[model samples]
Target: MQFFAPLVALVYLVAGAESACTGPNARTTPPPGAIVVDATGAYRGSFKTVSEGVAKLSTATGDSTLFLMPGIYKEKVTVPPLKGKLIVQGYTCDTTSYSANQVTITRAMAQNDIPASITKNRNDYTTTLLLKSSNVKVYNLNVANTAGNVGQAIAMKIDGANYGIYACKLTGYQDTLYANQGPALFAKSYINGAVDFIFGCTRRLGLSHATLVDFQKWHKVFFCTRKCFAQMLKQMKHILVTSVTQT
Candidate 1:
């Protein structure tokens, strides 16, 4: 009962945060002075690509935000370790769920496609977004690796501390979302994959009100090694896997 109280409180808090982050009442537009990336150039001084906007940010820019317009951004994005907090916000109509995510960072990189000179490992070759910066929050975005079950394709690779993902969608075949090293809070999100989708040596991971989908028809799903599970239970202080629906 003692442990259950705090757990319940945490779940309620996550639910409240989710409600606040989405819906018609929520703040639809990006915060003022945010680096805007719009494909159509509808917003003034907006970059055409996500990479271009990220390049403009620096250590001097305190508490920066990247606001993405509604479009499919087909490019490999890496948010290199930064100084202050960085918030990447995606434009969405129904911000309450991942189904309405308008911004997609997608790529078609597979093990067979990557050159031998780059990396032999399938994980390194198939990453769409590599976020190494601490104190980063990504909201209402869809990150996907469209290799179509070819090999190990990663939608996003998260490494660092104090990361949070809210109302987002991560989709791939194998090894979809990699929490390499960090303590991350994933709330109100949907993750879809076939094999070993959410496998990593992450220090701590908190999942609340999330949907984990196995898209492999009649094939085995949820592949995590015993060593990794043991590590997660031993090394991590608080590893919450609550309200997760497998579909």
Candidate 2:
């Protein structure tokens, strides 16, 4: 069974995904490009928590539709070695649509300190996504942690996973958008954060056909048409990101 199992979990991770075990009938078939969070064999409706849906699958890799019901989920989550063309989606209705909250894959430290996995990876200068596989995708979800009462934290953290983040909104206070590692693509997404939120934060990162915004007053928009500051101090190989437009 392990051989036939997905090499990774295509969690449609908004920068996260996890693997666990459950009943056979519980493997819900999420809609194409939708992330799942329910165990009804179909990606629809709400579950008690996000874990309820994730725990049902042995491995969450490959093209999947993971839909999450709108609610304030007070839980800490982690997508351990999750990979593939995954799409994490949120269940939204004009009536039940919520604006903000926190959903973390990292163990919170001080609301500002990245997260346990991030801290460990960064401190050790390791890979960002902590990916054990590839072709992973994420969208329409927030993945972060405010463990130490820091404040509104990151929305999506694509540490080191190959994927895409499309048509989503990420809200937080500090280090909001952590592309710590990304040989991936991010398009048409709303990322909110303060204090150099998305600067010198990731490597080998690619931002193509995407609309990026940094609300922080001090944060600069490095929307150059080339490889941005390739290193921590290289100063945007071409130009720097410093522009914004409201629609």
Candidate 3:
């Protein structure tokens, strides 16, 4: 009973609590100069690397922003439920100016498994963004996997509750975005996949105002599990799937 009380309390507190953070080198505050990550959210500090900032959030579960300084912060990250409310922002990343941001959150997940079975699951390995934490929000950032095409490499994989992913883009080749067993709502977000991509077999995924952009040098969207794709199409409308493409 005592343990139950603490777990219940944590869940309630997390649901109501709002944590916010920006990259390490985010903009400074004005007037009072209270440095903040976003408009209402406040900025915590400058993390030389994303791991440092993520560690801070893992320690502090409240609304806090970890402003990442403009640089190429390369590492893998996992967002546990204990740590919530993270806002990672950065400067423009392009080929021209080196000042651009190149934060690659890597995971050992492979890229080429026709069947894509439990044996080939990268959950066994470290990942960039492991959304085990519920009621979390990630904004204004780019998550990439530089592990060259070999097996089933995944970008953003979520298996939690009430996720808010906005104004951000996830780039990868195969199995890029995996939303497992979670009721997710993805808006104004861009997802690029190759085969059986965006594969959330069990989760009740609600994707509106989203872009399912695919760059399949061979085929745009292919379903390896034929029976599964047929099941998804049974409930979803062809027009609704096409509407996602418009975004």
Candidate 4:
């Protein structure tokens, strides 16, 4: 849970990202070799579904970028191991922060959905977005598992190396983000969960200038970070915590 200032600054580039989204679900045509997933089919060379776009790029050999239009995409997305880097961009009104993020990836599945016969950790099976490709970068997106506060439901699971998440929001009730392994950098983002929202045995995690929402109300509950975790507030960037009681 350590926040690296230099790494956070270097990972996110906000020079001209505001132009990425001109209107709701409106995006320019992606250049050659690039993939754009639009909910309204507003952009040329765009796939109507996120799964279709990701499936097509998972087999390619070179670098590619996936642009997601502003919409509530109710689907599970998995980026498999690929040869080149894959960049996913969520359309936002303002690219410099998360206040204007309109793209959301949501799924409703919990540990209860799995059979008890399986002897593995139930959290792994509740992930909505699974990232297994190296050198993957995601920006200004919101991922959520709407399985209520009943059980473990992971919003995003990162199993890739050299992954960077910028200005994104991850939400769930329990086991929100399972940073299984590899070094990951999450900057200017928001993560919310009730129990063990951030867990796993990762080598290193750099969470800088991010807001962590604690939906469960309990006094003096400090979560665990397997190998190492650090809290940092560089330039007076606070880890905004909001405590909510769920009935």
Q: Model 4, range 1-247, lDDT digits (tens) per residue? A: 2478766665564534545556554333354667788899878777888888898785657788998887899998888898988888887766667777878999999988889997775666788999988889998899999998778788999988998899999988888888887678888898888887877757466777778778775321234542244431222245566787755
Ranking by lDDT: 1, 4, 3, 2
- By lDDT, the best candidate is 1
Native-to-model Cα distance after best TM-score fit, residue 48 in candidate 1, in Å:
0.6
Q: After superposition on all CA atoms, how large is the RMSD of candidate 2? A: 14.1
Greater lDDT among 1 and 3 belongs to 1
Off by over 4 Å in 2: 1-46, 60-64, 92-133, 142-153, 199-201, 208-215, 218-247
lDDT tens digits by residue: candidate 1, 107-144:
98877777777644457557899998999999999999
TM-scores of the candidates in the order shown: 0.79, 0.53, 0.59, 0.79
| Candidate 3 local lDDT, 42-141, one digit each (tens) | 3444445565555656444565454444344456666656554545444432322212333334444453433446455544243456677677665545
> What's the TM for model 1?
0.79
Stronger candidate by TM-score (2 vs 3): 3
Error of 3 at 47 (Å): 1.8
